[model samples]
Target: MNQSTNPSEASLHAIDYWQVVKNRYGVILLTFLLVFMTALVITYVMPKKYESTAVVQVRQKGTGIQVIPGMADASRYQESSSAMFFPTEFAVIKAQKTLDAAIENLDLVNRWNTDLETVRRTLKGIVDAQDIRGTSLIEIKVRYNDPKDAQKIAKEVAEAYRERRKKLQGDYSNQALDELRKAVIAQEDAVEDKRKLLSQIIRTEGIIYWGDPSVSGGPRGFTKADDAESAAKAYVDLEQEKIQLESQIETLLRYDGPQLMNYASGLSLPDNIIPVLLPQYQEQKRQYEAMKSQGRGERHPMMLSQASNLQSMEKDLVEAVANLRETLKAKLSLAQEQLARLKTRMDVKEDDAVKQGIANQNFVDAKNDFETAQRLLEQLKVKEISETMQTKITEDPIILHEEPMISNVPVSPNVTLNLALGAVVGMIFGIGVAFFLEYLDTSVKSLEDVERYLQVPVLAVIPKDVGVLYKQSGMSPDAEAYRILRTNIEFNRKNPEDNAITVVSGGAGEGKSTTLVNLAYICAQGGYTTLMIDADLRRPRLHTFFDINNSVGLTNYLTTELMLEDVILQTPVDNLYFMPSGILPADAAGILNSRRMSELIQDVKQRFDLVLVDSPPILGVSDASVLASEVDLTMIVVQHRKLPRNMLMRVKQAVENVGGHVIGVVLNNVDVRSDSQYQYYTSYYTYYAPAESQPMPSPVSSQPSQSPQPRAASKKTTSADDSKQDLY
Candidate 1:
């Protein structure tokens, strides 16, 4: 006995995709048919297109074979080969030159029914060209409505491309040859100028090979320079030797020491006096010094005499050294003079050598230039001859290798592919449209919708147009729905006698009145004294169901001192009673909201087992809200797929805000027969209860259906609710 509203779980269980598909299958089918048919019509009306192709062979024209380094002629000429050439032809096909020729050939402007510009544009769209891979060929394709016309245009395009290509190449060749001839003539002039410069250099500088002398075998210019350097080196050596000799002689003359003895001997003393003089003088000096150190007095006769002998020897030695020094000085003077003269000769020789070397280099460079210019001029002449011959040998770069054929079949209006695309597009669009419609629909369509959106249990499912169901002779399907609603109502309420329930709706024509009339009829048939009141003074309808007058009812009772019995009338159905919406006062709501109305309601509840009041739409009038406040429990009769969820919420809020208890919702007017989403409510219809004539099983023993319908009551006559529902 879980009684709480679990909206999330309810909503989750309610979104059945199969249920949606079943219910919206008709919409999907209709949309698909419409879209598919449209595609077919458009495809049928479109124009057909034919195609023709032509092939042209491109020749690789070049500067006829030459083996020159840095030669650009061959590469430059072959630059117009297929790689760039095919695209150029494609451009040519669309080019004004080529297109103009084709137009004149075919009279395209008149045939296409357009101006020159329009025809050109149209032709551009219809034509295409591509190179044959690994081959020197190109194919030109053109499309037209007529096969013959396609072939004709393609042929004309090939002819136009060929005519223009040859003429352009011829012109290019002439321009290239003219440039080459000018270059050759200019090169010849340069060679002549080079020869003149070489001749001028030979005449000005008497230059030949560098290391060679003049006409004679003996050195004249270069030899003189060589001899000068040699003489200069010899003189410098002699001067250094003389200075060493002079230094030896001077040092010997100054010495009275013993070393002068060795110097005089090694220094090659003269034959007459130097050898003995030096040796004897050394001995005497040594003896004198030795005696002096041994304490011999200076004035001693032997010492004086030895000192005198030493002085004489020293004087002779000094004279000999002086003579040698003077001779060395004379040799030094001669060496200095010779060194200066040789240095001067070396300087003059070097200056002459530097100038002659520069002149020789200039002459060599000019000679090499003359040779190079002569060779280049010869090469240019050969190149010019090869180019002249090339013009005569070159073939057409573009020629038709394969002609276009008249296509037997049109390329467009592919019926199969178009239909397939149409189906895919239609199905995608149809599904989107179906989901979009489902999103826009905000009405409650099923029991799950009511329970989930309103957060309330569905008390009953009153089938759509149930008047016919009740009119049928078999066990009534609709009667059972109302009986289930009754049982649920009795069990859902806390107290059995708390039955002052007002059935209301959020909007008009939601079958809220019908639901109440039928529910009341079923309740009375279930053996309860159910008194019905139409408190909706704005537009009363309960009296219309009872086929009774509403001139004197609840209004009369409330306004005057009338009793409950005065207004309440016995209904034709068993245990059912009726009260009409009597004369409406200017303030019908004022009358309904009075203490008398409250007393009247309570009195009827005490008299009858159940008091069911029918009221106007809760959102439309305040009269229902007032009645709802006075009632014990309020039941909302919501028409399936008629009112929005928000409006139903408003109805529930209207009742509860007035301090009334809501028993539950009655989902009325459901289309169980058509909408598969609601079909589950009537899914048990095939299983019938045993016929009434047979003895029935005891109620305590027999298990009732989860959703049980009413058993047949012994053939009753036409009921009050049935007659009124038929009228509706």
Candidate 2:
């Protein structure tokens, strides 16, 4: 059964913790005072130390040229600086190099009369460095017994760091400048080598170099005399002339007579004769057609003469056309010959151009290389000059803002802070101890502890030092506890006739007898006939409360043939009776376990309304267990916070093992004032106090009276000493 804590249970737990603290307040207070006083004494006796501080602003390292660009550590840059930068700087300030420099500056070896290592160790111990939050400022602090030495050490350390930083920065700058100069010299040599290669190529190739017209002075490609283009143009013209001549010759040969004359007339060749002869042939033919139209016979002389003239003109035209065609053939032959000559000339020029092209390509390549080298040389020269100027510009990285001075007031042994811390720690430690002790103690703390462990209801809670209730005048507030016990016993019993309850404890002095006496008195006052039997033959204590004699009681009756009425005596309190243990018996458990003791219990139950029995601690002996078995009900008297929970459980086990019926437990001697959780159970004491004017009647008579005889006097008669009564 796992239980979760509700708000009510949580509140109960808090109250339980507070109750523990209240109960052990003395231990907590003692622990707290001891710790607090120790801190005070230590603070008072510690030696004083004076502090001197020097303030300086440590700027982040600035951007500088790198011999190898993009290779510098980013932590040196102001924008890229990280949290570790200042811490690293602080470490540098306390480094051995800086401290050695400070020691040498102060001549600490001779002044302190120590060796070099000792002085360095002393300086390291006393010096401290830290950065101001959200700033680049550093504070160098030194502490010593003498204020002047502290001041000197603080100032010298800061100065040493500044000087060392400047020297390092200068060295880095000079190294970078040297690298830049080497780069410039290398670039110059590269440019000169490129120029020499260009000159060599020009001398070998025999090409004309065109100087660059642009401001950058880059290479312009070389040129050569080229006759191949002019030769090719002349050769194409001659070839076209030959094709036209051949076309005219073919036209003259394919055509004849009038068609040939018409086609030859259209030709405009330089050497053709067709245009000169064509017009004469046309006139002759016209004359012939005129004769034929006049109807002249073939034998007529005029017609014959006209035909003869036309035929002669035709022959002259044919002969002239043949001569013109032969001239065109001759002209075509000349054109072909000229074309072949031009081809040979063109080929010769092409060969020369190809040779010049090779030389030009070599010259261009060398010129490009020289131009690239020259450009790089210019850039390097500019960079080198800039770096040379920058090396002379020095800026200090550390600025001393506040010089160190001797402090008059000591800074160590802060009394107020130490005392406050001690108080807080002591209180926490005390609370822890209180809770630890409470955990170890398993005694019954409240009614819950009783019922939860014993599985029995807590019938009542009896306060501490509650004397015999029968002797209290009027109404004592403490009597209410016993009355509540009386009522609980009556209700808890299943049968009203089963009213024989023995009040027993796990150990002696747990207030078992006192609780029995009180409860019996309360029951009598409530008008019930209650009987208290002292069955503890080992150590009888009930007779002491009433100052009654215990010479002849329960023991005498059980050991002899005396009747029960001889032991039972009525007290002065109304309706209350007692039976004391007459003599100390050696075997108390044997006597109490006998059939005679069982009969006495049954006889008393029938005679009285309620019978309360008192016995010794059940754990120590078997007498209480024997008496417990003889009774109808057993009531356990448990002292609060006295017995361990396991022991209480064993007490209940002792009774039940003997066939005794346990009614419930009575939590006796509770201090409700300190344990606030139980206050509510006993809070009505003051409010219910008896008024001075309303005092109740005294239950006991002032003077001794004659003892009344029992109702069953015939069956069990008492001895003749019944008239001698003692009321004191």
Candidate 3:
């Protein structure tokens, strides 16, 4: 017996659940019928309802007037915005105000003979508005007892919602138009102010406009003065020339001869002669150098001629340089006088350009402002006209996609669906209850449950309703369980001397006496000299099984000076004997706790190969505990799924407390057909049963013959034993 739980073993399988269902099928069937009948009754009694629906497409539309252009086209174009938009429309369709309007239009209060508040509430309850998924269409559904009423309510709701939306649009348009008119008036005044400013600039400055200022760059012409940049350019040119001429004149006066001529050659003044003469002087000097290179003296005729020509050219160059200096001086004086006069003209022209520029800027600013204001004013007028035309020819944004129609069929009391739901719910609830009761049931359910709690081996699982075996006509399949119990006891007992075993139970009606009788018969059939002793002093039932006289059994032997042969009786089954509980004792536990009882058990253990003693329920009285202490071993008989696990454990503890060795447990009265876990253990019941073709074994005598006795009680047992045996 392992105290630890094996997870795989502890978990239930599908077969286990099926077994539970089979065992409790009556309870499950009853619950299912109850639920199904309830559903049937409800469906039969429910009121019928008719449904009508109206479908309309709701769209995002603009107000008739747009204060700012293009605002209408920008509304509700995004996918996310459309998602949010439809819910709002649905709410509007189902709004209380809309419902009230529908109610008033249909005259529901007077027609239904209800108050105004009740009519409103009924209309709201009957009407349902929702948007069809992935579309802008809204469905207004109405349900009522009358098909005509349902249809009328749906149609009226749709019309009311449409009219409400249109009214809201109209109100918004009127407000926008008023704001637009104010904007247009303010724009017109702005344009007039700009126009007055422009005219004042034109009259004061005498500037003429060439073309439209808005179309062109700006005001282009200034009639009062020309551009001053021209005068400034001429003054700048002449002043630069004056500075150059003075620089050349200073260079000509500071130098003399060839240096003066070279300086004059570098200066490019107007009509200077030094450029013409310097080349002739340079040619003469080159010839003089050639003659010297020819080895001719300065006084030689050719050299003298070249030298004389160089001197003449040099004197001419100097003369030209001097003349160029005087000419530069003359130009300097002329440029200075012209620069002074032009500076005066440039100042006057700059003053005129400045005045003209100021006037032109004023004109351009005023003209731009005026043109902008005029364009805005014109747009406002166009918008106003467009808005007025739109208001006159207004179209409804809500379009009726489908008209409401009267439905002939009723929508409520769906029999098929209700029956299906009832069946499913009933099945689920029944299974839940089955498992719940199983959880609360702490009885021993399996062989493992007994071994786990009692820490003892399960000797055998006795199939439910096993009767006294020796009296059966032929071999009963149930006899195999006692055979198993016999084999287990033989193997479990360590010493041959420890042969006297008493069978006990936690509570009465647990088949303790039956198990003892069957085990003795099986052992006797297996060729062991087996003895059954009914030691239950409080309730003597073993003598009833054999129809033997209980008046001369154990209590008689323990109380009087009687030999063992006087009480022991041989049953019709060979090698099997019975010791009946002779008489009821006033003090059962006291009678069984004597030294004589211990000696009797030891004496019988030697006489019989196996001795089995039956006792009352150990937890009920002290007689079983007394017997358990006197016997060599105590075997507990536990009815399947009857005694609680803790109570079974207490039975084992009771035996141990009295210094008795517990051989094992016999799990009796199991419903093997329903409990699938034990099917394999007892499947041989049919497999090993004798075939029908075979003749039945000769019937064992149902009555037991008493051993030779001196008392007259044996004669009284003869008549009682003659009757048919009771199958316990």
Give all TM-scores, in the order shown: 0.65, 0.75, 0.82
By TM-score, who's the top model here?
Answer: 3
Lowest summed lDDT across 10 adjacent residues in model 2 is found at 719-728
Top lDDT prediction, candidate number: 2
Per-candidate Cα lDDT values, in order, are 0.74, 0.81, 0.80
The 10 consecutive residues of candidate 1 with the worst lDDT sum are: 704-713
- Candidate 2: which pairs clash? none
lDDT of 1 by residue, 667-718 (tens): 8887776676556766654444335365522222111112222211121233
Model 3 lDDT tens row, 1-728: 45455555556666688878987777788888888888889888988889999999875555235545553445324533655677777777778899889888989888999898888778777788887887778899998989999999999999999999889877876887788889889988888988888888888888777769545654567644555888888998998888877777777788876777777887776677778888888877888898899899988999988888888878877777767767777778899889999999999999988888777777878887888889989988887776666667666878899999999998876789999999998887788788888888999998888777788899898999889988886778888888778778777878756878999999999999888888888776655566889998888798888887888789998999999877888877766788888878898888899999888887887666668999999999888889889989999999998988888888999999999999999999999888888899999877887664787343233322334432211211222222112111
Q: Per-residue lDDT tens digits of candidate 2, residues 564-650?
A: 778888888867788889999888888888999888888887766678999999999999999889999999999988999999999
Model 1, stretches more than 4 Å misplaced?
A: 1-28, 55-92, 110-114, 129-139, 209-338, 364-386, 399-402, 445-457, 460-484, 500-502, 506-632, 649-662, 668-728
In angstroms, the error of model 3 at 197 is 2.4
Task: Kindly report the root-mean-square deviation of model 2 from the true structure over all alpha carbons.
Answer: 7.2
